[model samples]
Target chain A: MGTFHDDKGELHGITVVVETTGPRTYIGRCFEETEQGIVLLDVDFHDPAEHDKTKDEYLQHAVKFGQWKKLAKFVVPNDEVAKVQRLAELAP
Target chain B: MPYDPEMVRPMREELSSAGVQELTTIEEVDASFAQSGTQLLVINSVCGCAAGGARPGVLLALKHSVQPDRATTVFAGQDLDAVNAARAKMADFPPSSPCLALFKDGEVVHFVPRHMIEGRDAQSIAFDLVEAFDKHCVAAS
Candidate 1:
């Protein structure tokens, strides 16, 4: 995982490159900076066969914008991408 | 708090109409939790699961004979500072919206995490909260 400062000198973006070791991994982006902690902008378990599943998972945990600072991005491995594609095909 | 204000207005209205106070600032959150009594802090969200489960469940549970001394909410996405400030008080718990925290004298005694809210209906969550209220909130005299 790597984060970069923007031209404005703010921590504006992040990138994560991963090697999958198992079925899934958890990823989140913090919404704020605080002594206690930052609230996550999004969280999900990723598996290639289940990419759509990851999307739905983030929707489940999505909070209001008023709750925390929005993070630039969040990424995790999608080990179950095939399963996700299959599910999408089955969806109406 | 979880969604845009336009999106969350109905929810904020529902909770406010039900007597749940909305905390929109850090000062407000601090004042509410600092009070010497049992408090229920709801981390409100816009998720369907939260709408179908947590919010209604909390409303129903509030009808119980025993309930938290103060009932408050912080919008997860919309009220950023307020939510962060509220969670700061919670300490150590990962940030989760559509979550519930039960506090006594400014200390967290019980936490109902997000995973507990998903895949459950409103009634089930209400039953859980009513049970918690009966156990921890009833005796707060």
Candidate 2:
């Protein structure tokens, strides 16, 4: 998990969670807000073949809408990564 | 389909002519943000907001005496990886194309999301940004 700080060096109350979805790559999500920054909870979903494409697709959507602010990512542990990976596999 | 390089070329030139750097890679993004002063990152797009409002707002804002130390842009659809790379560096904010990010020493200070620019006119947005610049960029000292 990582935090995003503002200009005053104060936390933006945002947390980013990073979960592994591949060998070296991770998927991150925000879960809580803090005075210093946001807290992240990692999700596990580590299927390279599946997650890679999905990641690219999500990024493409963000790019298309000029929604670049939504693309923050972070790195995290393997177990947490696997959880999101499994979840992604089950996702419709 | 890919964007028309020829069409965007002119727009790119206009910004460059105004002294804005074009960040086409993650490294460039890092370098620009890592610098020790206020920076303006423009999420450039071909949408109506970009063409009708954001671009003009940027031009007007640049004319302000109290502006950022540096100004840069990334073409959304055209510069896919570069845009994504830059977004990753931003960390928390949700993605909003045709967006405007004000960074001071690699940290995001002010963000103007797409919704903020969507229906607004150039002058109005420029006024907002210039105000931000005056407060954050100039008054920082």
Candidate 3:
């Protein structure tokens, strides 16, 4: 199996949906990756605990409509992140 | 291994200068949590967001009239034992450096993880920390 390091630069500049182990989820353009976390630019982060939309509903809407940018840049820690995928791959 | 003590001296001093006690050993961590009343525990890190936001924000928050009974900090890379002990106290929280937690009578009442720090200015961070302080901390005479 490849290490997390192997995928570091490959995702740069791609619009990806990132789900974390915590309450938040992010959809943004991957700017950089470090041992610490993935740096995302123009991110739309949603915490269902504080928002009206469920994670599934948000993902569905984002897949069809595209992400709504909220944060200009942020880091989603590697340990807290559950999954990261290309936004285009989610299209049906 | 711990970070070069000299290199991280300034980072430690930033919080220490603001009256946050440094917790460098497991014993210190245990003793601090054992105390009654509210305390603020900062898991310090060398990350840029920490330097730019968390530390400055915490300093500003402490200026509020209402404040925790005590404030303490543990360097993430330099104080391994204390950091681990602190994390054990906050088992519910996912481990993250540049994090902050408020404890009342030994229970965590509020927490600010690294994600909340990233991409924010010190003023924004201080605003949130002050909100937590107002809600959870009591004013000292």
Which candidate number has the best TM-score?
3
**Model 2 residue A32 CA deviation in Å:** 34
DockQ of 2: 0.07
| Model 2 lDDT per residue over B1-141, tens place | 547788677766767788889998888877777679889999887665677778889989999889898999998888888899888867677675678988888888887766567557899889979988987897435
Q: Write the candidate numbers in order of decreasing DockQ.
A: 2, 3, 1
CAPRI quality level assigned to candidate 1 from its DockQ score: incorrect
Ranking by TM-score: 3, 1, 2
lDDT of 1 by residue, B10-82 (tens): 8677777899999999999988987998898888887555677788989999998899899999888889999
User: Looking at candidate 3, what TM-score does chain B attain?
Assistant: 0.97
The C-alpha RMSD of each candidate to the native structure, in angstroms, is 12.2, 14.7, 10.5
TM-scores for candidates 1 onward, in order: 0.64, 0.59, 0.66
User: Model 2 segments beyond 4 Å from truth?
Assistant: A1-92, B139-141
Clashing pairs in 3: none
